[model samples]
Target: MSAHAMKMLNTLLPALVAVFSASTFAGEAQIELKEGAGRDTVMANCAMCHSIDYIQMNSLFMKRTDWQATVDKMVNVMGAPISQDDISVILDYLTTYYGVE
Candidate 1:
C-alpha cells in the first residue's frame, strides 16, 4: 500500500527467503560423507537402500578394508547396482572419514 510499507516488505521478503534457504540446506550440512562423495552422490547412490544414519553412525569406526567389503556387499549382495567408481568413492569417503584403527 504505502511506499515505506512496500520497501519494508521487499527487505523482509529476502531475509525470510534466506532464513528458509539456510534451514533447508542445514540438513545437507549435517551430512559428513567423504569430500568427493558429497551429498548428492550419497543421496543418489546410498539413500535408496539405507538411511543416512547408517552412514553417519559408522563414521570413524570401520577399517579401510572393512569399508571396502561393506561397499562390495552393497553391490553384490544388496544389489545396489552402483558402479565400481562410485563404490570406490563411497569406500574412500568412509575409510578416510570413519575408518577404525
Candidate 2:
C-alpha cells in the first residue's frame, strides 16, 4: 500500500479496534431471577427497558416497599409501558424473590 494509505490506516486502526472489540464489556452479565409464576411477567416487561441485572443489583438491599416505589417510578415517571395486570404480577415477583427480609 502507499505510504499515505498506510498512515491513514494506522491512525484509524486503533480507534476501529477499540470500537469493535467485544472484550471491553463482554463480561456483562444478566440476572437469573428466582423462578416463579410472575417471574416471566417481570422479565418480559421490566427487561424491555433495562437489564435484569438492575433488579438483581437492587435485590441486595431493596425491600417490598422499595420495589413498589421503584415500580411506581417506572410506570409513572419513566413510562415503562407496564399494564395494570402485569404491574401487579411484576411487583409480586420482585418483592417475593428480590426483596430483603
The model with the greatest lDDT is 2
Off by over 4 Å in 1: 1-39
What are the per-residue Cα lDDT tens digits for candidate 2 across 17-100?
987665533533433778998988987898788768788889899988899899999999998899999988987898888889
Predictions in order: lDDT: 0.75, 0.85
Q: Which 10 successive residues of model 2 have the least lDDT summed? A: 22-31
lDDT (10s digit) by residue, model 1, range 24-88: 66875676555554456666888887667677787656798877888888889988989877777
What TM-score, computed on C-alpha atoms, does each candidate reach?
0.58, 0.72
